[model samples]
Target chain A: MKFGIMVNEGPYTHQASDSAYNFVAAALEKGHEIYRIFFYHDGVNNGTRLTTPPQDDRNIVNRWSALAEKHEIDLVICVAAAQRRGIADADESKRNGKDADNIAPGFRISGLGQLLEASIQADRMVVFGD
Target chain B: MEEAGETKKIMYVNRKAPYGTIYALEALEVVLIGAAFEQDVYMMFLDDGVFQLKKEQDTKALGVKNFSPTYRALEMYDVEKIYVEKESMEVRGLTADDLIIPVEVKSNEEVTKMMTEMDVLLNF
Candidate 1:
């Protein structure tokens, strides 16, 4: 099955990110294809490169980035939501005159249209949030 | 149960009130955009979500744009399957008459059964 996952809350603040991660990992292990992973609202915070957790703690952002890299999954952060939360890519940073880009690896900033496309193409669209 | 090119049954479960947070408005935005896809869309008002359909909303005092009027425009998007939970309405001292648009008042059992038939379920 092809699955589209949507994360609507940031890490640490809610269990949504963790649950989505575990569900995706399990789905991949079973050889299912991930259509896309869309981050909206506070969920865009999961794509920031500035997060630095304690050495003993799990790095939520890095976990997502690594998983996305390994699986070659398209991790999309909503442009509107990302801008409001200050999650920017190189192009966005340059356009907005920001000093640097904070978008973590393996994640791309795009429009909500990507989300709608995912819903149409994927066999199932699952959302995790508050 | 979904096949390629098939129109999936998608349901947006609104469980929160409007204005207190952005969930209600954002969820509605998604619904509006999704109308273009021509899917079998359904909106369920559960818990405080029933408040979103309350009529005669005045947002001038709150200094926010009142989105209540947008509910009336949903019919234009071909999204007319709006369901309001009967228990949720009763608990809030509301009725179908209090809402801005016409909706089918469904009992909890009926709504729960309907949820099982959906291909995609989004809660806000």
Candidate 2:
């Protein structure tokens, strides 16, 4: 079945993000197709390339990046939320004249419309936040 | 008529003590994702949810800063229209004056009317 996952919680605090990650992995391992992952609000923090967990802690950002690289999943962040929080892609950073882009690869900036569209198209929209 | 394009309206209700548990924060997480999908998103807090509306929550002893500060920022994301049940406030020993932020306070009938209006209800 096709799945659309949504992550709303920030990585540093709650287990929502972690649960979402594990659920995505489990779906892929079960031979399911992950349509896309829509990050909004604080969930945008998970897509930040600048996120560096402590040496002893799990690096969630890098883990997401590697997962995307391996599975070719579409990881999208809400641009409105991202920019407000100072997380931008290369083009956004260049367009805004920021020092650097903190958005990770395989993840693009998207709007709520995309998430709406995915929810409409996918077989089941399985949300992972809260 | 409910059109095929019309998504289900799900309210991510938050009614819990903010510090002792992760329910309130978790509720916001759900709302964010629901908003990302542009679904008919709405959040309501009744009963203990009023505790979450309190502005200053110093959780330093637990090695955590006040995460309640983020609630104020939620409005900027177009997440306005948070509702509070007035009866829950009174029953829980809270008044409108005790709450930190401004919320749309409603009676039990009003809250029931709004909640029943939803097609899919998810509680956390």
TM-score of chain A of each: 0.98, 0.94
TM-score of model 1 relative to the true fold?
Answer: 0.92
Candidate achieving the largest DockQ: 1
lDDT of 1 at B10: 85
Tens-place lDDT digits, model 1, residues B19-104: 87888988898788778777899999999999999999888888888999999999999999999999999999999999999999
- lDDT value for candidate 2? 0.76
| lDDT scores of the candidates, listed in order | 0.92, 0.76
Candidate 2 ranges beyond 4 A from true positions: B1-7, B12-44, B47-87, B90-124
Docking class of 2: incorrect
Q: Evaluate every candidate with DockQ and list the scores.
A: 0.38, 0.11
- Which lDDT tens digits does candidate 2 get at residues A54-126? 8999988888899999999999997867777788988889988999998887789976665656666667666
For residue A36, give model 2's deviation from the true position in Å. 1.8
Residue A98 of model 2, lDDT score? 97
Clashes of 1: 0
